[model samples]
Target: MKKIFLLPLISSLLLFNCTPKETLDETFQKINSEVLANSKAYATLGEATSTIGHRLTGSENGAKAEEYTYDLLKSYGLDVKYFPFEVETWMRGDVEVQIGNLNKRNYEVYSAVSLAHSPVSADVDLEIVDMGNGLEADYAAKPGAVEGKIALVYIGILPGSPEGTSNLHRSEKTALATDNGAKGIIIINQVDGGVLLTGTASVTGGLIDIPAVCIGKEDGLALKEILKKSKKRAKITMTNTSDQIKARNVIATIKGSELSDEKIIVGGHLDSWDLATGAIDNGIGSFAVLDMARTFKALNLKPKRTIEFIMFMGEEQGLLGSRAYVDAALKDGSIDNIKYVMNQDMSGNPRGFNAGGQKGADGFFDKVGEHIKAIDSVAFTNQNSNSAGLHSDHQSFMIQGVPYTSPNSNLDRSIYGCYHSDCDDFDLVNEEHIRNNVRFSSMMLYALADTDTLPARKLNDAETKAFLEGNGLKLKLKIGGDWRWED
Candidate 1:
C-alpha cells in the first residue's frame, strides 16, 4: 500500500477529534499486515474441501459441513449459533446420453452432464430440435414442432445480441423451451474445451418438469453442425434422488461498542454444488468472512456497530438458508437491526467493492473505495458498482429493502469455466486472492459498521420497489417469481 500524502490531506486526519483519520488508516494497515502474514482462510478452506468435501445442501456432506463450520466458529471464541432450515435438495444420479447417427447408430455423448434439479429418473428417446438461442422468438418459430422434441440451444446469447436485445438467463431459456412444449432441453456451454458445468435448470430451484442437460462447447458445436446437415436424434437416460432436507446457517457476532442494535451482516453460502469441493464458488467467500472475524478478534478490534459473520447453507438450492434467515428476522422483528449486508459470493480477488443496495449508494461506496485504495492500491481502486444480481446470498437481503455489497472484480470470468464443475476445487483458488479478500472486505465491513454518517440504511417498502425498478432487477425478480409488488 502506497500512502500518497498531500499537504491538505494531513490536515484531514487531525480534523476528527474522537476517531482520527490516522487511526482508521492504522486499522486498515493492521488488518492487511495481519492477513498477509497469518491468514487462516486458505488452510481452513483446504480443510473444508479436503475433509468435508462438497457441501451439497440436504446431503450428508452438507450436514457435516454445517456442523464443522459451527464448531469452527465456536472455537474462535465468538458468540456462535446455528439456524436450521429445510429445503428441497436434489442429488445427481447416473446420467447417460447418446446421439444417433443418420443410420440410427448410437454414439457417445461426450462432455455432458444433467443440469441440477432436473427431473429424476427420466428415459426418453426424443428427437432433437435446434432452436438457436432458444429465445421467445425462436420458440415461436417452431410452434407445435417442439411439443415432443428435445430443444437444443446455446447456454448464452448466440453470436451476441443485436442492439437493444435483452438476453434472458439460461434458466429463463429453459423455462421458455419447456413452456413452449419441449420434452427436454440441451444447452450448449459457451465455455470452450471439455469442461462441463452444472447449474440449476429450474428458475424456482425445484425440479423442472423436463430433463435439461449441458453439453461442452466443442461437443455442442459438432452436434449443431451435424443437426444442420442431417436430421439426428438423441437418447437420454437419467436417475436422480431428491428430498426435502435440513440445512443450517452458521452465525457469529462481534459485539459493537456503541449502537449495538444496529447490525451489519457479512456472509457467504457454505453449501455448494456436489460436483466438486466448491472451493472457489463459496469456500473463498465464506472463509474470508471467517478469517476476517478471526483477525478482528486477534487484533481486539471492535467497531461501533454489531457485525454478524454468517455462513449460509443451501444457496445453490435457491438461497434457502438466507431466506430462512430473513424470514426469522422478519418474524422476530430483528430485521430492523440490520443496516447493511456485504455478500462475498464468488466475488474474490477484489479490485473494489460493489454496493448492490436497493437504492443508489455510489457516493458512499466511492468514499469507501478511496480509503481502501489509499491503504492497498493493488487490491482496490476507484471501482464501485451499484446494482443487484441474483444467485447469491445477498439477494435474500436485497429484496427486503436492505442495503447490500459484493466485491467487484474481473477475475470472475477467469473461473466461469470451472465455476460449478469438478474443476472447482482447492487447486483453482489463489492464496493471495483469499488473503486480499480477507484484508479488503474486512475493512469494508468495519467501515460500514463504524461510519456514523454512512448514507446507507434500510429502505421502506415503496422505496425498495422503486430501487429494484431503477436497478433493472424488476424483470429478473418477475422471472424468478420473486416480485412482490402489485399494481
Candidate 2:
C-alpha cells in the first residue's frame, strides 16, 4: 500500500516539474531582449581600442590581440583553440617622398606611406609619367611613355570613364607598372582634402621588385597640375622589413546535440592595418562576433548543427590565416564537412543578408529574413541580395566551393572615408549599429544551424568557375593571380 502511494506522488512531481520546449519565435524574442539589456560588445571594443591599439599581424600588438580574444572566448564557457600557422609577414618602416623638378632643386617634401610588401629598400628618382586609369589599355594608348619613369596612377576609375571600363586593384596597377619597365609607382588617393589610404600593392603576397607608395589626394592633385604645366620628377625612399613568424587564428566552437557533422563558420579578420586603433574597419565586426558568442553561451541554446566563431589573423597581409585553414582542411579531407561560411569584414548595421552566389538559397534566406524582421523590423529591412566579392576571408572558403554569406550593410558615409586610414579609430563606431549586427546575425546563424535541410551544397570545380565568370570576377581573380581555371 505504501509503494502504490509513492508511485502516484512520483508521477505528480514529474508532471509539475517539466516545462515546454521553446518555439523558434520565442527563442528569437529572448535573444533580442537579452542582447538589448546586457550587451557586452561596446564595452569590449572600447577596452580593446584603448589598450591594444593596432593589431597588425606578426607584431607584439598582434599577439596581444590574439590572446585577448582567445581569453574572452574561453571565459564564455565554450570550446576554443588556436589554429597556428607560419607566414612571412611584412611591416612598415621609414619612408620618404619628394616631388618637383629635381634638377632645379625646387622639390617639395610630402608625407607618404609605403604600401605593404614593397621592397626592403628603395631609392629612386625619375620623371613622373601619367598613366590614366592604370589599365592595360592605358599603357597601349601611350606606348613606351612610362618606361624607366615613375608611374602616376589613379586609385579609382575616374568620373565619366568609358562604359564597361573596369578598374583594377592597387596591386594589379602596381603589376601593370612593373611589367611596363617602370622604375617606381605612386598611387593617388581618391579622397579629397588630404585624406590618404594604404594597403598591399603586391599581387602574390611577396615583396615587389620596385618601390610603391601612396600620397594624399590634395598632394597628388597638385602634382598633376604641375605636370600639366611642365615635367616633374618623384624621388621615393623606403625601408620595410619582412620575416617568418607564427600567427594563430582564434576559434570558438558551440557543439550541437544532433547533426553535429555539418558545421557553420562565422569569421572576421582580426588583423588591422597599423594606421590607427582600427575601431571602425574590423573592430565593429570582430567584437560584435565575440558578443554574439557570449550571447549564445549565456542563453545555452543548442541548435541542430555546430557553429564556430573565428577570428582570422593576417588578412590584411593577404588572407594568410584563412588560406592556411582552408588548405589544411582540404589536405585532411575535412573540407567536405563544412556546409557554409558567413564572413564579417568592416561590416556594420546589417539591414539584410547577401547569399553570395549560392544557388537555390534565396528562398531559405528570405524565410529567415522574415523571422529577423519580426525581432526588429526597423533595423532589419529584410532586403536580401545575391553576389560574390573578393579580398576578404570569405574568398578562401569560396574558392574551395564552399557556400558563403555576409551581412548587407549600409554604414555611415563618413566612416568609409576612414577605411585603411589613420582616422579608423573608436570615434567612428556607433553602439546601436554594431548591436544590430550581433543580435540579427546570431539569429540567422542559429536558423542555419538548426534547419533540417540546407538549401545549398558545395559546388564542383567547373561550377565554381562558372559562378565566378557569371559574376564578372574572373578578370579580377586572374589579375590577382588567384584564377585557378584554365582559359
Candidate 3:
C-alpha cells in the first residue's frame, strides 16, 4: 500500500510540473485562432491610415495622430501615457529656383524639406560648383571652399547594380555638404524625364544649418549646358524658419499576470512627410500594432510578461521620438526590464516581410519566423542588420543593448518604388499583408510574454554565418570580434 501511494504522488508531481507548459501552448493556439477569426482587424489599419492621414513631425497633424493612437489604445482597456520631448521645429516655406541665360524661365523644382533647426536664408545669388557625386574624394578636393556658394550635387542613384535599393549614401552626401559650409545645395534627380522628386531632408544630430532642394533631371542637364556655354551662375532664393518645438511619444501598456516585470514593446512612428497624408508610410504600421493591443485585451488572455505599445512622433524628422524615449529610459533605468522590441514601420506592401536584428538574436528571430509561418500569410527572411540599432525607433533600444526586430518587405530595385515618396498612400496597402503582419506580431508577442524560458542569447560565428548564408543576406558584421562568446 505504501509503495502504491508513493507512485501516485510522484505521478501527480510530474503532471503539476507540466501543467504551465501545456497551458502556454493551449493559450498560444487560442490566440492564433482568434486572430484568424477576426481578419478585419486589418481594417482598423485602413481606417487609421485614412482618418489620421499624413502626420509630419511637429505639425498639428502629428499631434492629432498621437492623440488618436493614445485614445485607441485606451479604448482597449490598457494603461496609456504620453512621453513628451523637446525638438526643434522647422516649417517649410515657398522655395523657387531659376536657371540663368538659357531658357531663363522658372522651372518647377521641389524643395527638399529642410532639416529642423537649420538657419533661415532669404533670396541670394551664389556660384554653383558641381561636386561630382559628393564622395569623400570630392569633398577633400575642396574643403570649406563652398562658403556662401550653392553646391550642385548629382544625387546619384544608390550604388547597387540592382535598382531601387535605399540610398543611404545620398543622405550622407547631403550631410557632408551641409557640414562643410555649403550655403545651400541643389541635387539633380536621376529619374526619367528629369521629374523632380520631393522628400523630407532628415538630419540626425541636429538641424542641418543649410538649405537644400532637388531639381528635375532636365533642369540639371539644362544647367550643365548653360555652364558649358558660358561662365553662368544661378540665382536661388529660399525662405525658411526653424525653432524649438514640443514632440511626444504615445505609450500604452497591457499588464501581465505572473512576470509583469519583463516587457515586450511594439510600435511604429506616428509621423509622415508633409506632402501626402502619410497613409501608408506609417499610418498602417501604427494601426496594426494598435489593433494587436486591442486583440490581446479582447481575448482576456493573461500573459506572463507585459506588452507595451508605442506610437512614436518625429520619426520622419530622424526618429526623434524613439531616440528620446531610449535616452530617457536609459537615464531612468526603464530599459533594464525590457525583454525585446518589435517594430512595424511600413506594412502596406503585399510582398513577404524581412526580419533583422543584432548578431545574437537568431534564436528569437527563429521563433518569430516559426510563429509567422504557422499562419501561412507572411514569410520571414533574416538579414543580420541591427533591427534596433539603425535608423528606426528600434535603434533607440539597441543603444541600450536591448534586442529588437522589425518585419518589413524587401525593397531592392525590383520592389521599392513607393518608400518615402508622395506615392506612399492607403490604396497601395494590401489587406492580406496587413492582416498577416498583425497576426504574426501578435503571436510573437504572445509567445514571448507567455514563455518561461528565454530564447538562446548568444550566437557563434558558424551559426551566424550559416543563418546569413541560408537567408541570402549580404550584411557586413559590425560588432567587434571580442563580443562573440563561445557557446
Candidate 4:
C-alpha cells in the first residue's frame, strides 16, 4: 500500500515538472510577428526627423526631443523616465565667409556650424596660408610660415603619408596656428570633384580660443586663387556663442516576470545637425525600436528579461547622454544586472546590418549574422578581433565591460558620400532595409533574453588589457583580475 501511494505521488510530480512554461523559440516567433504586423516605422521616422526637427546637443530642441521620445515610450505602456545630465552647450549663430579678390569676383562660401562645447567668437580676419596636408614635415619646412596666418589645411592626409601620423592634423593645425597668433582656420575639401562638406566641431569642451570653418573644394580653390593674386591675403569673419545647455536621455522599461533584474537595451540617438533633418543618421533607428517595443506590448508576450529602450540625446555631441548613463550605472552598480546591449544606429540605408563588438563576443555575433542572412541577403561582417569601439553610443557600455553589439553598415567608399550631410534625408533610407534590420535586431534581443543560459562573458583580463593598451585606453583594473574598469 505504501509503495503504490508513493509511486502515484512521484508520477504526479513528474507530470507537473514536464509541463513547459514557455520555450525560447515560441517567444521569438510571437515577438517577431508582432513587430512585422505593427510596423509604423516610416510615420514614426518622419515625425522624429521632420516634426521635432534637428535636435542639436544642449539646445532647446535637444530637451524637446527628450520629452517627445519619453512621452512616446510611456504611451506605449512602458515604464518611462528622463535621465537628465549637464553638458557644456554651444550654439551656431550667424556665420559668413566671403571671397572677392580672386579676379575681383565675389563668391559666397559656407561657414562651419558650431559643434557642441565650442567657444563663442566675434567677427575677425586671419591671413590665409596653405599648409600642404598639414603634415609635420610641411610644418617644419615652413616653421613660422603659419605664424599669424590662418592655416588652410586639407581635410584628409595625403596618400603617401608618413607613419605614426597624428589623426589630429586638422585640429592641431588650428591649435598650432592659433597658438602662433592666427585668428581662425579654414579647412579645405579633399574631394576630387565634389563640393566641400562642413561639419560641427567635436563636443570636447575647451578654451583653445579660435574659430574654425570647413569650405568646399570650389570655395577653397577660389580662396587659393585670391591669396595668390591679392597683395594682401584672403580674409574670413565669423560670429558664434557658447553657453550652458540642457539635455536628457529618454528611458523606457518593459518589465518581465522570470528575470526582471536582467535587462537588454535597444534604441539610438535623437539628435542631429541643424543642416537637414537627420532621417538616415538615426531617425530610423529610433522609430524601429519604438515600434518594436509597441509591438511586443500589444502582443502581450512577456519577455524573461526586461527590455529597456533608450533614445539618447547628444550623440552627435560625442555621445554625451550615453556616456553619462554608463558613468552613473557603473558608479551605482546598476550595470551589473545588464545582460547585453543591442544598439541600432543608422539602420535605414540600402546596406544591411554589419555587426561588431569585443573579441569574446564573436560567436554571438556570428550566430546573429547567420540568422540575418537566412532572413534576407543582409551582409554581415565580424569586427570582433579588431576592437573598433567608440564609434557610437554602444561604446559607453563596452567601456564598462558590458557585452554589446551595434548593427552598422560598412564605411566603404560608397557609403561615406551621403553620411552626416544635407543629403541624409528620408529619400536616402530604404524601407526594406530598415524593416529587415528591425526584424533582425528584435529577433536577436528576443532570442538572447529568452535563452536558458546566457552567452558567457568571455572578455578576460588579458584580452581586456591587450585591447585597452592597443587602443590607448587608461583603464582601472578590477581586483577579481578578470575584467577592467574605467576610472
Q: Per-residue lDDT for 1-487 in model 4, tens only?
A: 9999899899999999899876544555665576566677776777676777777777667677778777787878878888888876556676666544334355445544432223566555545677767656767778888776667766676556777665553545555556556666677766544443545444233434666777666666666666666623444655566666678888878886689888888868878766666776777787777777776677776778888888888777567788888888879978878777777777543233333444445566565545545544534332223244555787677656666765654433543455565556776666665665566677666766766565545244566556655655443223112134443
Q: Deviation in angstroms for 79 in model 2?
A: 2.0
Best by lDDT: 2
lDDT assessment of candidate 2: 0.89
Q: Give the TM-score of candidate 3.
A: 0.77
Alpha-carbon local distance difference test for all models: 0.84, 0.89, 0.64, 0.64
Would you estimate the TM-scores of all the predictions?
Answer: 0.92, 0.94, 0.77, 0.81
Per-residue lDDT tens digits of candidate 2, residues 1-487?
A: 9999999899988977686657778888888998898888889999999999998988999999999999999988988999999989889998999887858468778878899989999999999988878899999999999999999988998776788898888999999999999999999988877777889999988899899998898888778777888898988999999999889999999997698888899999898999898898789988988988999899998988889999999999999999999999999988888899989988888989998877677778889889899888999999998888899999999888899989998789889988898788999999999998988888888888888887578888998898888888898788777889889
Query: Residue 419 lDDT in model 4?
Result: 56
**Which residue pairs in candidate 1 have backbone atoms (N, alpha carbon, C) closer than 3 angstroms, thus clashing?**
none
Give per-residue CA lDDT, model 3, range 1-487, as digits (tens). Answer: 9999899899999989877654544555666677667754457656665776778777777787778777877877888999999977676666677545434444434334343334466565566777656666567888776766778777774233244433444456677787777777777777645445555444444445566777766667667666656644556666766767787898888887888888878888878876666666776777778878777887886778888888888876667798788878768877777877777787533233233544455565565555555545334343223332255676566545565666655333422344555556776666666665666667767877777765523234465445434443323122211122232
Name the best candidate (by TM-score): 2
Q: lDDT of candidate 3 vs native?
A: 0.64
- Candidate number that wins on lDDT, 2 or 3: 2
Estimate, for each residue in 127-214, the C-alpha lDDT of model 1 and write its tens digit. Answer: 8999988888787777777888899998777675565656777788899998988999888888777677888888877789888888
The stretch of ten residues in a row with the least summed lDDT in candidate 3 is 476-485
